[model samples]
Target: MGRMSDEPARWTRATVYPDMWVDPADDPRDGASPDGELATLLDFLSGYRMTLRMKCEGLDAEQLARRSVPPSTMSLLGLLRHLAEAERDWFNWISDDDPLPKLYGERDGDFDGAVGEQAAVDAAYADLEREQAATDAALAEHPDLGERLRKDGIAVRELMVHRIEEYARHCGHADLLRECIDGRVGQ
Candidate 1:
């Protein structure tokens, strides 16, 4: 009474309908070449960034900044700003340069200040892109993931893995938030 060897893996993403945000063929992240660890990690990171943007797509400033979840100031706009701040922090940690002052002055300024304003929304997107690019540039300097960064010698691989984890967790939160906002689901 053993399972069939030819059967697919236990974990599958099968769905009744094409409920995903994008069609399989249209998914930019599909068919990503497994070039290497660095390449794979970077690709996944980029895909997650794209996913976050997609989740926020077609939404107005108010929608983007709405704290849909009660008792939690967690909004899509706040996540975007917080991500930018987090991305900037990692870049500083990797370089040990501490180049820019923190994005938001207060401890939770990133989220707390995510007001429902078009200007804030635009700035968040811009900041996220700018910080991501800066981090990518700094990351290119170290090809060896095993290499330790200057600040406290945190390995490059650890940092990359952490970035992926952070994005994935937030993306899950986003799925819920977006569903609550407009009933749209699937990634």
Candidate 2:
């Protein structure tokens, strides 16, 4: 017995709660109380990261790279690339004497170059994971949230908050893009 001929090509919602992405018990975000400012910020950041991954789950290269809301080039693949680039910049900024070059070249290259190809999709995920790990390590170097990234730049706390804000915004775009591709919707 294999997949029925009448079954959809891709998996659709079949949870007890039809409107959500997954059952509450299966959600990956941590529910434990954070211990401090740094812990709280990190929790939010981690949750947003999981949310973005959840939005991109089960998508193929074409679906991941599909643009959403006419006139906007935003896509889940693009967001993944953009976030990777962002992590490199912000995390490395603290130790750099000068500004680093864009990971994808041009300012909008992350979104503009998000082609629907298996290699591109694989690269995006790899880049994001590598960058995220590096960023986390860089962030851990300075336990002080008040530590300034640069003499005239913002502090670690501010940078962390900004990074979370960026993820939250892009995750919103991911949500819409995923829904447009398939009609799946959830928090």
Best by the lDDT measure: 2
How does residue 110 of candidate 1 score in lDDT?
Answer: 88
- Candidate 2 residue 125 Cα shift, in angstroms, is 0.9
Q: Per-residue alpha-carbon lDDT of model 1 for 1-187, expressed as tens digits?
A: 9667532232213243446766676677788478899999988898888889888988898989888656888999999999999999989897765577899788889888989889999999999999999988998999899999885899999999999999989999898778777767756
Best by TM-score: 2
Distance from true position, residue 46, model 2, in Å? 0.8
RMSD, one per candidate, in order: 9.0, 4.6
Looking at candidate 2, what is the lDDT of residue 143?
A: 84
lDDT of 2 by residue, 60-169 (tens): 99989988877988999999999999988886677665665678998899999999999999999999999899889878988898888766677989889999999999
Worst 10 residues of 2 by lDDT: 5-14
